[model samples]
Target: MASLSLPQVDFRAAAAEGAADARLREAVRNNTLRKQEGREARWTELPDAQALRELAARIKQHTLENLDYYLRQLVDAVRRNGGVVHFAADAEQARQIVLEIAQQTGCRRIIKSKSMATEEIELTPHLERAGLDVVETDLGEFIIQVSHDRPSHLVAPIIHKDRRSIARVFSEYFHAPYNDDPPALTQQARLFLRDKFRRSEMGITGGNFLVAQTGQVCVVENEGNARQSLTTPRVLVSLVGIEKLVPRMSDLAVMVKLLARSSTGQIMTVYTNIFGSPRQNGERDGPQEFHLILLDNGRSQILGDPEYREVLRCIRCGACLNVCPVFRSIGGHAYNSVYPGPIGALLSPLMFGLERYKDLPQATSLCGACGEACPVKIDIPRLLISLRRDMVNRRLSGKLERLIYRLWAWGLQSRFLYRVIGALQRWDLRRRADADGWIARLPKLAAGWTAQRDMPAAARRSFHNIWKDRH
Candidate 1:
């Protein structure tokens, strides 16, 4: 490992570039989002948007409902198309499979693209530990990789670091005498990576969607690196999340239309490749062998939970992060998960289990901006509420916290219980009341809430209490 200037999480952050790209997009999003909001404001005006959303929702719902059947069908189709499929239950198993493949093919160098599934598993460090030279090819991913920084955004991993910081990274890493300039820094990486791509023995990528009907694997990338990686390498491997399968190629048309547009406001990326097997009979350039690793690191457990199945439809467009005020302020690092922002808050717990990040679901203001920004129209806020319910049901919340909710529920059960507590609090609250309707200081347990903002002096009188007396 290189002793770099960036945060420890930065390395992990860039591996999932879209989550990182969020940093760069946040400001620009403010101006552009207004137009998107205007366009979406007239959502009723564009009935087609709702119609497309319904179609997408139904398509994903159907796939999730019959997950087993679709996964098996996808595997069979890929195998029949002359591609190999490997199933990994967790990160260790996935890494081992990749390691074994790398060792088998005797690969020394590899080029990779932006893949959050790979990051959630923390596969890159494992590969590096296995002593393989892994290179990130996406511009943002590459910058973060070289600088040893985490991604602050979902779509642009190196968004937090502007050209000046990136130029310093290149200068330090490559000894390329240069100043802060985007084109100069990009060209430096370009020239440096060209040789690495040409010499790499294997290339690893993530799939956008797997079509079971035609056995086609779709990859959407902005740079030409994905094509170069697949074509230049002797062996090509795609590490696809199990949930990425689409029942048929026709379904891909709809998703493709919405994917890049929603993510970057572009109609489509610079490259969109869909090829099942390697180069057919006499094709010029493509991998000699193709392998697909279907990973299930807790996706199956989530599928059975009725409240959250629709979350699987996320295309990783990052529109939610762009619109989220919280994401804009503290950024992705605070969440401390590979998937950050609105989607991360919901998906991380379900995939990794809720106990570790129980506080994350509550990290929202219940703004619903995420749901509004979503391209596939994932009801993120609804899913977030479901997660909160799960947390309560599991009793994972702290004892004091649980006690408060229980007390509130009990109080709501009857008017008498509420009045008694209200009277006691009103009398006690007056001693500490400030003209501005705030109690600046509070008890120990309540400090967390008041530490950040002023808490209204326990409302002088309960609304219902006053209303009942006047009425």
Candidate 2:
């Protein structure tokens, strides 16, 4: 019943705002730390966790390399299984395709499962403008819709919201007494959404994995809302990115084993829906019409570049988010895309232009936590560095920033200049130190470094000087 449109994202501004919010930071820190711990515990249950991650990565890479062949095979298979396939070159086309389907079906009441693809295209607002009543069925998504707020995390959408804020939102939305209890909030949403599920004429979802061998769209979720989206409507549509394809059912099996564990540390989600075709003659109930929209907004560009194609291996498990220090502190809203965290830092720039999301590449600390936590073993930090390099090469970085780096390079080229600059920097920094020998503030370009953290005063003697004295 409600929708959200993301405004122009200023990563620096948003990151500062999120960092300044103690409550938001605490909420994100607690949730992500818990999930990170859970993921570590779950991975230990495996005989060879790293090996499995490598195998999964290989499967994805192989599929991406031969994506055309698998996609063709998938299209043929889906057609044979009584499913229609649509290709969208971009976001506008994707929205238009779904609108056409709704128009053709003469459908009005629509219920959507939690879908990042849908969020990426801002589908709900488009559908609403077409005079359709669309409801978000997933609990977190439902809350997001009700509050007109964007999701801050892939798996845990409301990680930025604490119980008290959620209680106020629920109270205001339902016009009922405040209740912060998790079960009560869930029950409240369930009761409201059940009616929408029963009466919906069309259902929309996003595919977690599209199995090329069997033409089945695999969707795993902790809640049964996705299950309801599949069964309750006369028409069902799954809008998925083209990169979601896995070569075979066996590959899908391997992915399933890691997805839930990486996301929430569960061995398996409560619902795992694998459906492609419309209901058969003998079937009691299922969608009468099925449509799969393959979206390629910017994936083809990333896939074509061998240097960064590994970024596509991301499965949206939110494992990287849980382990990323920047995301844990500043939260997902700072990334300014439907995708967030370490993966988003790489993706938002690649999918969107480098200039549009230039700041995203600089968001990471390059701590390698995301890379280690990634279930598919995607080299996240490497790819982020790649994106950062691209930003510089493409002249997306500020002129002053580029000039500063050039000067730094020039200084480093000569030993004398390097020593001179190092000594001057140390002397200046030490001069700025307070009585406690901590530099609490800095001027100009170095101001941001001291904004949130104090720099330790430099030693009186340089390492070179100390070495000369010893000699």
* Candidate maximizing lDDT: 2
| Local error of candidate 1 at residue 349 (angstroms) | 1.2
lDDT of 2 by residue, 191-233 (tens): 9898999999999999999999888899998789899999989
Q: After superposition, how far is residue 388 of candidate 1 from its true place, in Å?
A: 2.2
Question: All models: lDDT?
Answer: 0.77, 0.90
User: TM-scores across all candidates?
Assistant: 0.88, 0.96
List candidate 2 stretches off by more than 4 Å.
1-5, 434-436
Candidate 2 residue pairs in backbone clash: none
User: Which stretches of model 1 miss by more than 4 angstroms?
Assistant: 1-47, 435-438, 456-471
Candidate with maximal TM-score: 2
